[model samples]
Each structure stands twice: as C-alpha cells, then as structure tokens.
Target chain A: MRNLIWIGFWGLFVLHQDFWYWNDATLCFGFLPIGLAWHVGFSLACSLFWMAAMKFAWPEEIEAWAAESTER
Target chain B: MEYLSFYIVVGYLALLIVLGLVSKFYSRGTSADFFVVSRTVGPVLLLLSVFGTTMTGFALVGSTGKAYTSGIGVYGLMASWAGLMHSVVFFIVGIRLWAIGKKYGYLTQCEFFRERFASPALAYLLFVILVLLVIPYLLVGVISAGKFLQGATIGMFPDLFGLPPLVLPDGTERQHPLHGSIPPEWGGLLICLVVLFYVFVGGLRGAVWANAFQTVVFMVCGVLAFYLISQRLGGFARATEMVAISPFASNRLVREGNMTQLYFLSYGLIPLSVGMFPHLFQHWLTARSAKSFRLTVIGHPVFVMIVWLPCILIGVWGAAYLGPLATGQNPNMILGRMVKELVDSQILSGLVTAGVLAAIMSSLDSQFVCLGTMFTSDIVLRLSRRTYSDEQKIMLGRIFIVAVVAVTYGLSLLLKDVALVFDLGIWCFSGFAGLFPIVFAALYWRRTTKAGAIAATLAVAVSWSILFYRDMLSDKPPGSDELTLFGVLPVTAIFLLSVLAIVVVSLITSPPSANTLRKFFPDERLSRR
Candidate 1:
C-alpha cells in the first residue's frame, strides 16, 4: 500500500510537468497564463504529497535510530 | 531614500555580527562544537538554515533578471523541480547520512567516503574535486552581493572617494544615474570582510542562527516587495493584463526560442546536486537527530514557492513596465531598479535592500564555514596523522577560511561584466550534479567500490572542464545557446558518463569487503536479496 501511494504521487507529479503543454498560451481565469497557473497548482499539490510521504513512507528504523540517539 | 537604504543595509550587517558573537558563548571550545554545533540544532533552525543556504542570491536577483529575458519558464525550469526534488533528496540522502554520521562521529563528506571505501587516497582525491566545485559557487555568492549592493545604493556616492568619472573611448566623461554609486569590486570586498568576520567568530552555530534570522528578514520583505510592486503596477490583475497584451506575452506562456523540451527536462537533474554539496553535508551533520530533517523535507517546497513565485512574477511584469533594457546594461540590476521605481518610501526600500542582502549573506556564511571545516578536517588533520588540540583545529580552520575568502574576493574583482547570475550559477550546479551519481551509489549500492568512485569523480572533472571550455570559446552566452547532445543537456551527458564509469569500473574491480559492506548497510543486504 505504501509503495502504491508513492508510485501514484510520483506518477502524477512527473506527468504534470507540462512540457508537452507548453504551447497553450490561453490565460486562466482571464489573467494568469495557463502554463504558469498549472505549475502554481502543481506546487500546492506537491506540498500535500510530500506531507503524505512523511506520514506513511518515512523509514521506521530512522525513527528508532533518532530515539536511541536522544537517550544517549 | 537611497541613503536610508544604504544605512539600513549597514545596520543589518551589524546585527549579523552581533549574532555571530552571541553564538560564541555556546561554543564548548571543541572542534566538533565549532564545526557541527555539537550536533544539537533543533528542527526549526535546521529547516531555516538549510533552506536559507540553498536559496542564495540566485533565487532573488538572478531569477528576476532571468524572467525579464526568458519569461515565466524560469520557475518551471528551476524552482518547481527544486521544490519537489530537493525534499526528496533530504529524505533519501540527508536522513541516511545523518544516521551514519552520528553513529560514526563523522564531520565531513570526505570522512564518510574514506571509511565507506576504506581508502585514504580516495578521500584526498574527492577533497580536491569537491573544493574545486565549491570555489565557483562561492564566487557566485560574492559576485551577486557586489552587484546587489551596487544597484541598491545607486547615486548614494557622488564622487566615489573623490575619483574622477570614467572617460569613454570618445574622450567624453560617462554619466551614470548616481555619479558615485559603489562599484562591484568595492561592494564585493565589503561583503567578504563582513562575512569573514562572522564566520571567524561564530562557526556553524553562528551561521545557523544568522540563517534563521536572515531567512525571516528576506521572506517577509520579499512578500512585501512583491505586494508593493504589484500594487504599483495597478494591482495583480492589471499587471497580468499588461503582460498578456505585451509583445512578450508569448514568452509568458510558452518558452519561445532556445528553450527546447529536452533542455527543459534535463534541468530536473540540477537539484539532485544537493546530495553532494559539502555545505549541505555539513548542515546535515548538524541535525540534533535523524528526525530533525522531517520539517526541512516537508516544508522546503513551500519555502521555495514563497521566495521564487514573487521574483518570477516581478521579472515577468518588468517586461511590460520597464520595456527593453539598454545594450550592455546588467539585467541583474532589474530587480533593484523595479524596487526603486515602485516603492515611494525610503525606509521600506531600505528594508527591502537589507532583505536582498540577507538572502545573499545567509548562503555566504555557510559556504565560508563549510570550506573551513573541510580543509581542517579532510586535509590538514587527516594528512598530518596526529591528534591536535581543539584550539589548534579551530585556528587552522580560521586561517584556511581567511585564505579562501581572499582568493574568491580577488577573483571577483578580476571578473568584469561576467555572465548573468543565473547562467554562471547553473554551470556551477551542473558540475556538482555530475558528481551526484558517485555519492548516491556509495550510499545505496553495496557493490560500489573505491576504484569506481575514483573513476566517476575523474569523469565529472574532465567532462565539466571540457564543456566549460567549450562554453567559454563560443560567442553564445553560457546558457543562451540551445546546445544538446543526443537531445539532452550537457549535464545529462556528464552524468551518464559518471554512472557508466562507476558501474563498469566496480564490476571489473574487486567489490568492497563484506565487513565494510555490513558496517555501512547491515540490515539492507537481506532486503536487497
């Protein structure tokens, strides 16, 4: 399940890069350019994805290691 | 207003010096305390210091100028990729390194490589390559500080210490907006001296505290500068409207001309350079615990957004408002010019100027301290093969730090109207990125050998030198030409060569001993099978 989540997040993340969509000059909401707007939204999504990764995919041993170090 | 801004910048420098002195109290008079802050930095300070060091002047002054010339694509090419990838590196490379560092009492990257490969000669080779890669990066910081100071204090000096105006080839005295604005040479020298003083006194702990404070100053002032500039351009909507109808509108949406798809995609590799940065390695070792990196990994993207979004927008907006800059004018001065034109209050502009300097100096202090640590730990002490007192180690580091600052400052003075800040910085990042494969493999792959690591390092050095020389010879600007090999960036070529050298050489050579492998990755071997 954790592997699936990482795959899904990275999949969407890489796809949204929008290199192929660079030709679109249409303005979004009548002001922001579509390319720039796409990235703005994507950046926000990345923040959530990264937070999720921290919650689920973080290495358990690292947590244990940190706990051990502090006790010393 | 100009004088006020100069005074504010001076005051900011004084504040940083005080912060440096305060950190001295925390020093335990040990090399470890001086180099890695006794390994006791909390999450918040670590997050701020790491983020602050990564941003540099390129995020502010360079990005604005890049946006003016290239368009909004600058954000996608650099920032967005960095936002996601930098965090990924922190999670993968940073935490693991911290775990290993703490367990082994390691203080520098060379020490880790030496132990992992069990080869002292390899450590010496890596040290030379790493220092060579770092000096150009240090030069970038110094050059940008000089440029920013000169631009912010324009017209504040009329006579330039009573020196006459420069005469043009036509025998006419040249006229500038302010007669005696500080030149890049003098401005760069002043910044070097100030940074040297703090790093001399405070060490890594001083750099961390200063980074946290400077991070706040730059972020708050950056946001304010963004808001004020947009408001002066008749609000965000009006500014967008202006850019939408301008001749450069196409540049805003699509990367028009020279920004090819392959080239754009290759920039994704650039942020991976963080894994190999000596300064970042130093910062990673300073973490109080492995868990301290959690905040930095999660929060880095948001910080990148906050800082980069404004600079990119301001640059895009400059297209319509400022129009085309004159020939031979420094595009790096665009951000400074926009602030002067938009802000009416002297105190506000003064604060903003200090904010820009804050961003530049935050990175400068860390680089200075990191180099000092590397020389003392990796070269001097390692080669001498004798134990030294804590005072001797600290004094040796300080002497090397002073030497580095003097050399970099002297180089900055010799440079006249060099490449744009973004262009010079990208080349430096490319060299480090090319070396990333070696470090990544050493940490993850048990088969990686000392021979392979040496081969990869040499490949990066040779390819970087050849590509850099080629770039210098061409009439095209460093990054302006749409040059690609097999439809990928020069960095991609260099990175591939490095990987090949490492993989093939390690296969032909004897693998690392089982004991060495167990020590580095005791639990991971079973999982790999």
Candidate 2:
C-alpha cells in the first residue's frame, strides 16, 4: 500500500508535466482548452491520491506517541 | 445604483467587525487564546483559514491580470503546481509541525526554531527576514483591494471624484468614470482599518472565522462573475471560440514555442513557499488534532482549482473582450473592469465588489494577526525577559499589530504606481520558497545542526536579495520574459543553493547533541514512552 501510494505521488508529478499538450489548443467540453482540461483532471487526481495517502500512509505511530507524551 | 457596490462593501466590513466582537466574547483573554485560539480549532475552520490565507487578492485580481497578458498558460504555471504541491506540503510538513507545536505550545515559527536548534541568533535572523518578506506580500493584498474597489465603483461618485476624459485611438473621447468614486488610497485605507479592527478585537480566532466566511463569498461570487461575463461576451463556448480565432488574443490559447518546459516546471518550486509562510505555520498549529489536517490536505487542491479556474478563465477572456489595455494601466484592475463593463446589475456588481474585498481582507486579517503574534511572542517577550501578564501581552500584540498595519498601508499608498501584483507576489513567494530547505531540514534531518540551519537561512536571504535587486530594482530591470537566469526561474537556483548550503554545512559541522536528536527524531523515545 505504501509503495503504491509513493508510485501514485511520483506518477502525478510526471503526468503534471504534460509536454504533449503544450501546443494542443483544441477545446475540450466545448470551451475548456485542452491544456486547461488536462489540469482539471490533474487537480482531481491529486485530491484522490492525497485521500488514499491519508488512509494508508498516515504516520499513525508518530501521532500516537505525541498523544502518549501529553498524557505522561 | 452608482454607490450600490460601495454600500455593499461597507456592509461586508460591518459584518466582519461583528464577527470579531462576537469572537471576543468567547475568547478566554489568555495570550494562548489570542495567538493560537488555544489550539482547539476544528477541521473545517482550519481548512478554510489556511485555504483563505493562501488565496488572497493574488489569486483573484493578480491572476486575472497575469492571465490577460500571459494567456491560458498562467493556470499551468502556478495554479496546477500549487494545487498539487500545497497538498503535499500540508500532509507531510504541516502534520508534523502541528504535533510538535501542540506538544510545546508554540505560537510562532520562530518560537519553534528557537527551541529546536537552541540558537536565539538564528531565530532572530529568521524573524527579521520573515517580517521583511511579509510586508510586500501584505502590499499585494492591499493594492489589489484598493484597485478592485476603484475600478468597480468608477463613476459612482463622478461629481466628487471625476477625472478628465480619455482620447481613444479612433479620435473619440471616453469619459473617465472613476472620477467621482473611491480612490485607491481610500480603498486601501478602509481595508487596512477594517482588518485592524477585527484582528485587534478577536486576534487569530476572529481572523479564522472571517476567513471561512470570506472564502465562501469569494468562491460563489467568482463563479457568478465567470458565468455572467461569459454570457455578456456570448455563451461560454462562443466566448472562448472568439478568442481562439481573434487576432488580438488567439495566441493566448496556446503555449507552443513561448513558455519553456523548464520554466513551467520551475513553478513547482514556487508553491514550496507555503512550507515557509509564517502565517500558514501559525494556522497549522491551530488544529485541534493531527487528524484535523486530513481534510485540509485532501481538500486543498480541489479548493484551489475551484477558485483559480474562474479567475484564470476570466483573465484569458479579458484579452478578447476588452481588447488591448492602455499604457500605464495596471493589469490587476482587468478583473474589475470586465465586471463593471459586462455585468450590469447594480446588486450583482455590489456582490462582486464585496467578494473581491472578502478575498483581500481575509488574507490581510490573518497576516496582521500573525505578525502581531510574532512580534509579541518571538521578539518582545523573548527580548524583554519579563514575565508579563496575559492582558499585557495581548495589549502589546495589539499595539504591534497597529504599527505593522500602519507601515504596510503607508507603503501601499507610495507604491501605487509601481506595484505589479502578480510579479511582486511571485518575487515574494520565491524568497519564501528559498527558505523551505531550512524548515524541512529542521523537521526531518536528524544530523542538521544549528550552524547548518543558520547558513542555509543566510544563503537563501543573500541570494534572494541579490537576484531581486538585479531583476526588479535595478535601473534597467529586465522585462518579464527576460527575468529568468539561463531560461529557468530564479526560485529554482535559490532553492538549490539553500539546499546545497545546508547539506554541505551539516556534513562538515559537528552534529547536534544526542538529547536534541532524540527529542526531534523521537522513534526510540516513542517506543520507550
């Protein structure tokens, strides 16, 4: 799960570069520019990736330790 | 109808004041309550305040103007990069900072630094550098608010504030309608006073409450403005199609051969500035639990897209509808001008004005409160060596807030002519980005020494200063397209140098004491505890 999360993180970073779309001015969804449309998808992907990260890769032990320290 | 926008803006200000007074009723009057809301902020308010502070007038006004000149590529340059990078920072850096801050009751970044490295000198240096950088940032919001109001309310008070008519290229004279309305200085002053009142009365609590309210207002109004303007130009599809074919702005729809791939990539470094923003650091500490960051980390990117898409699109469309801007025109006013020209309902116009004010003031209130917190906790309390009472500390903080507000407002008035909101804001963010290496090292690197931290801080400050002076302040400052070094943004170079300095210095210098390492690294200690 952690490795998958890491892969997703880098994948998003690589996909965000979108060099092929730089010159593609074709409109998507009637009005959205191809480049702009690409990013709207990128933004949604980021949200989902982060949600998965919180569920799988969150530093639970560290947080538990901090809470324990407060109690002590 | 002419003064309708102005009246709505005034009402919005009144609402903020009422929110502040109401927050004061709940405040415990302790220094902790005033500074970090006693570290009890829930997830929703935390998300809104952090998101609101990040957006500012730069997102709404400056972005539209930048999009006008640069085209649709503006969205790719900053918005998309910010949408992704900010969430990464919040999840990784923010959660840790919140945990440590809650453990130690840290109210400001410098306070954490002071304890982490056991170096007051480094903390003081960072405090000075942060204040210097933040003033320009505050100026961006102030200048944008003033310009937005001035452009929105033009001709509303024509008898009182009318200017001479402008001669067009076609030999026709157009009346300067802004003649009898609120001037930029007055607009800036009103915003400054209103922010000062709320921050003075309610402190960080008031700022956060108002930020949540303001965030909702701007997002709704932003979409409304986008929809109304698209309709005014034609339908959304037709509006964009016209620009795609028009001689004046067809080039804006594409980025081929103009913006370099390296340059577009360098913008990824700019949003790293949020990692080092003192205001954001303070906001992070206000979370009630480490899990409180979950919503912020997940929701931030979508919120950024929601706010930025409209502003960026409106800006791109401006080039087609408004044609070319006249000489000496501030691009920051393009968003306002489009609304005034196209969106004709007085009530709708007033709503838009209030929305812009909400975005601008939401940021200003937090920054004012943050600076005051820094001054009181990091500087005055540390230097004076006196155990002052809670009331006295709060009073001192309010006084410093007033002083900082005064200085920022005065500078905003003087720079009305020179301020380019987008460019100036980018430069400020670059400086902050350059400082991110220090903070990251502080949190994650067990071997990072106080000396390395100081060296990295100095390296970022010195490099940022030299680049800014050469590129922006020099008598022959480079044009926008020419500001890069070897075709890459200066932020990339500055960030690299700071990272290099920290790594080399840390390896060469004596490592931190075992006790210091244990406290920060804490895995062993965690198991023992």
Candidate 3:
C-alpha cells in the first residue's frame, strides 16, 4: 500500500500534464472547460491519495522520536 | 456611500488589531512562544495558517489578471499543478523538517542549515539569498493591495483625491475619472502598517489566529464575489458561453498560443518553491505533532482549488465583460474593477473588497513574522556576545519587523509603476524553486557536502540573476515572448543546473562528517522508508 501510494503520487504528477486536453474547448458539465475540469478531478484525486498516504505510509518512527524528546 | 468599501476594509483592519491585542494576553511572553507559539498549534489552526500564508495576493489578484489576459488555460498552467505539488512538498519536506526543528530547537531555516552542515558561511549565504528572494515576494502582496484598493475605490473620492492628468511611465495619461483616488502607494502603506501592528504585538500566535480568521473571510468573500459577478453577467454557464462566443475572447476559452505544453510543464517546478520558503518553514515548526500536518497536507490542495477556480473563472469572464483592455492597462485591477462594476450592493462590494484585503494581509503578517524570526534567532542571537532574556529577544524581533515592513513598503512604491504582480511573483518563486535542490539534498542525502551545497546555492543564484536581468531587459509584455530556455521557463533550466552542480560537487568533495550524518540522517537505512 505504501509503495502504491508513492506510485500514485508520481502518476498524478505525470497525469497533470494533460497534453491531450490542452486544445479542447468543450465545456464539461455545461460550464468548466475540458482541460480545467480534468484538473479539478485531478486535484480531488490528489487529496484522496494524500489522505491514504498519511494513513498507510507515514513514518511512525519520527513521531515516536518527537514524542520521546518532548517527554524528556 | 462612496467610501463604504474603504470603510469596511478599515473595519476589518481594526478587527485584526483587536485580535492581535487579544492574542498578546494568551501569549506566554517567551521567545519560543513569540516565534513558534512554543509549537502548540493544533491541526485546524495549522491548516488555515499554512493555507492562508501560502495563498497570497498572487493567488487572488495576480491570478485573475493573468487569467483575464491568458484565458482559462491559465488554470492548467498553474492552479492544478500547484494543487498537486504544494501538498507533495508539505508532506515530503515539511514533516521531516518539523521533527528535526523540534528536536534540535531550531527557530529558523538558517539555524538548521548552520547546524546541519556545520557551516555558518552557508547559513549567512542562505540568509542573504532568502531575504533577497523574499523582498520581491513581499512586494507582490504590497503591489496587489495597492492596485486592488486603487481600482476598487475609483470615483469614490474623485473630487478630493483625483489628480490632474499625469503621464504614466508607459506614456499613457491618467485615464480614469479618479486618477489618484486612494493611490496605490497609500493603499500599500495602509496594509503595511496594519499588518506590522498585529505581527509586532501578537507574534506567531497572533499571526496564526488572524490567518485562520482571514482564511474564512477571504474564501467566503471570494465565493460571493464569484457568484455575484456571474449572476450579473448571466449565470456561470452563460458567462463562460459569452466569452466562448465573443470574437475578441473566444481564443481565451482554449489552450493556444503561449499556453504551450513545455510552458505548462515548467510551472510544475514553480510550486516547489514552497518547500524552501522561510515563512513556510516557520509555520511547519509550529505544528503540535507530525499528526498535525495530516490535516494541512490533505486539505491544502482542496483549499487551493476552492480559491483558485473561482478567481480563474472570474478572470476568464473579464475578457468578455471588459472587452479589449488598453495596452498599458494593469490586469491586477481586473477583479477589483469587476466587483465594483457588477456587484450592485455597496455593503456586499465592501465585504468583498475586504476579503481581497484579507488574503493579501494574511500573507504579509506571516512573512513579516518570519523575517523577524530569522533576524532575531538566526542572525542577532547567534552573533551576539551577551545573552538576552526572552522579552529582549522578542523586542529585537518586533523592532526588525518594523524595519522590514518599512523597507518593503518603500520598495513597493518605487516599483509600483512597472511591476506586474503575477510576473514579479513568478520570478520570486523561480529563485526559490532553483534553491529547492539544496533543501531536498540536505534532508535526504547523507553524503551531501558543505562545498556541494554552496556550489548548488551559487548555481541557483547566478543562473536566476542572469535570467531575471535578461527578462527585465527584454521588457516584453507578460506571457508573451519573455526569456525562455528551450521554450520553457528559465526556472526549469535553473533547477536542472542546481541539481547538476550539487551532484558533481558532492561526488568530488569529501562527504559530511559521520557525526553530522548521524544527527540529521539517523536511521539512514530507513530514512526513505
């Protein structure tokens, strides 16, 4: 899961380029331009991916070190 | 009624001062408390403070102006990339830096670098570079505030404040009925004084509390401004359709001409500047725990989208509503002009203008506080012979904040005529982004030598200076035929040069001492994991 989360992060970076939609002027859902709408979805995906990364991939050791230092 | 918006903005400033005074009562009166709030900030305040500080006038005023000229493609060029990348930086760089800062009692990035590389030279070098980069960043806020105020309050005090027609630097005569009404210089000065007052008294705690509050105000006001403008121009769909169908602006609806793929890809590097921002570094150190970053990391992209989407749309709609702007017309004022012309209610317009001020001032306070922290903790305390009490340290910080605010305001005045808020902002971020390679290497690579870091720093500084000088000489209009390296922004080239310098120099020079490695990269095998 941690590895996959990392992969998703890199994937999103590449996907954000959105070369295909660059010239498209078609409005998505009657308002948003296609390129703009694609990114809106991309931003939402990034939010969810980050949430998952925090839950599954966070390095617990650093938190433990910080807490122990505070205790001292 | 003419001064209603200005009065509401004044009311908001008063509220911030009250909040500052209130925060002083809660402050612990220690240097630690004043600088980082003793690292007691929780998740919610942390989220808002970080977001507020990051979303400066650049996000609101500069962005709208850019979108007006460049079209909806502007969103893809920056907003979406920023949404995904800013959180990435926060997670990857911010968390580790916070843990190290808390453990070693680091109050500023200079302090951390000084200790990590065992080189005060690097720290001093970094201090100069960071301050230079930050001044223009500070100017972005000042310029935006001035332009917004001047643009919004036009015709309000025409008789009292209007000036005789004077030729601008661009050789255009003052065209508006209220040419000098609430001049940009006065607006910028007023914001500087208000922000300095709160940051001086309240310290980091005051700044954070105010940031959270201002974040709410600006977001609400932003949405209201968006909705009201859209309604006035027919609904959102209709406004966009109008822009799409208009012969003068139909090109704005699509990605063509100057919105090249290479140009868009280069913007991805710009958001990395946040990783190296001194203000952001200070904010990270104030987190209660690593868990505290969870909310900020997850919520930042969403917050960015919320603020940016509306501002971009408004700018796109401006192309149709405003028609062809005069060649010398400032785009920074487009959003302000839109609100003034479209939003009919004086009360609503006042609140919306105040909201724009809220976004601009939120960043000013944070940057002010961070500069003070760097001066007091990183430079003065480190170099002083005599020890000082917490109160004295706080006193020195407050004094320096005043000095920085004064210097920034003076610079803003000199550059007010020529600076495009968005262009100036991109240049500032480019300088910082070029330095990102050093920060990343410092945190992750145990073998990174002091010489290598210095070499990389010099690469960024030299490349950025030359590029900025060339861009200025070109004197081309924004987003059209400015200096580029291989058709992408000079930032991409500068970043690559820094990376190359770091790698080659680190391989050639001896690595950092084992003690230093143990300290910064403890559990080296598991560092990446």
Instruction: Write the residue-wise lDDT of candidate 2 on B1-529 in tens digits.
Output: 6667678878888999999999999999998888899888998999998999998777888789888888888887888899999998997789888888887678899988888898999999999999988998899888878877787777777677778888999999988756766899988998898889888999999899999999999998889999899999888899899889888888888776558888899889999999999999999988888888999989998999998899989998998888898986877778878887898778778888888889888888888989999998988888896799999999999999999999999998889878454368788899999999998999989888899999999999899989888777777634444478887899998999999999999999999887776666657576566
Candidate 3 stretches with Cα past 4 Å from truth are: A70-72, B158-160, B165-176, B420-422, B474-480, B525-529
The DockQ figures for the candidates are: 0.46, 0.64, 0.65
Candidate 3 docking classification: medium
Question: Which scores greater on DockQ, model 1 or model 2?
Answer: 2
Ordering by TM-score: 2, 3, 1
- Candidate 3 DockQ vs. native: 0.65
lDDT of model number 3 = 0.87
The candidate maximizing TM-score is 2
In terms of DockQ, which candidate is strongest? 3
Model 3, span B130-177: residue lDDT tens:
999898889888887887787677777767677778688999986666
- Binned by DockQ into CAPRI classes (incorrect, acceptable, medium, high), candidate 2 is medium
| Model 2's TM-score against the true structure | 0.95
